[model samples]
Target: MRLRRRVSPLKLAVLGGVLFMLVLVVLQRDVSGGIQEPWFEDLSNRKERMLELVRGAVNNLAFQIPGQPGTPQLPAGGEVDKNCPSGFYTQAELKPWLERPPEEPHSQGAGGSAFQKDNLTPDEKKEKEEGMTRHCFNQFASDRISLHRSLGEDTRPPECVERKFRRCPPLPTTSVIIVFHNEAWSTLLRTVYSVLHTAPAILLREIILVDDASTAGGCGVYQERR
Candidate 1:
């Protein structure tokens, strides 16, 4: 048998080294590129960069006050108070500081006494009635009459007046029921004002307002005559 050529150990070692280098290159391309570095590994560097950016922005916007060590500038024409470093007052903060009328000595402990005293006298009752007369006549009675008269007149064109009148159905009466649950006094009064202004007397028979379990003290006050 012919003798087979034997491979050299040196050549085999060289080939093995080349093969190992190729495998490492393939791993670096496929696995190393896909892996993300952990944030903990570079947290200190990232934090420093973020702090630098914030400090630069604040320095750009910050104004130096005269004779003050580190006071940020406020808007133009704004007043600063030593008590409030932020130089702003909320509604609650301003309410106690606002100027108000001097409280009456007689009405100090009386919650509803002022209104009750006015209702106790005959002259006061007459004055109250007179005051309410203007509101009732102008806002309610006259408005309702005007609406009724306007609807009673014919509004059809001359050409179709005769034909339309024959085919027109009778106007139906409507009752507007307003229900309020935990509604504000201003909101309830606005609803009544809107109905008085807009509703025609021919269509609207009556307006009924229903307040269901409201905690407001003056619900039925309007119903009572002076």
Candidate 2:
């Protein structure tokens, strides 16, 4: 007789969330009223709208009890502390650091307008096109931006900012895992920096990066440093 293993609820939630998002992406054109374009702009604008749906679905699944219709519940902050007292949120000096105004125009690809190819020189345009052909994205713009660049104030919602949680029972510490293959150096490093910058030090146990047989030169540099 062979034994069958039962999947954990957390694993089931993660798998279901992944499959849900994949299906949404696959049927994006049909669900989004047949809006289709080859460029990144079209997809970028609709991503937020798609994410809201995914969030709602995931949240609904997360609190589901066994053999019951999932009733979505908001996070219970009464028993656990959600906020970090020593986090960047309370640091007065660091508040301006991420959202600081740029000294020069078109510096570090600061705004949405910076991505427009209409303003690029012939040589610049050629380089960008070549980069896109090789990497399937705008490597040229990515190279110009700083790895720790500020995302500005409009990124978070007011409701999230205004919400408060209890500090009695501490929240669980988290270990972040990032996986990549042939990712650009600037973007990859930026993601690490972003996690370090935003996450509270006390709650962030460690970061584990998994490389999936990448042939890029960036991977060699990363491995050598390890």
Q: Which regions of candidate 1 fall more than 4 Å away from where they truly are?
A: 1-167, 219-226
Worst window of 10 by summed lDDT in candidate 1: 141-150
Best lDDT among the predictions, by candidate number: 2
Clashing pairs in 1: none
Error of 1 at 12 (Å): 75
Compose the digit string of candidate 1's lDDT tens values, residues 96-135: 2123233343431222222223233786556545535633
> Each candidate's TM vs. the true structure?
0.24, 0.48
RMSD of each: 32.6, 19.1
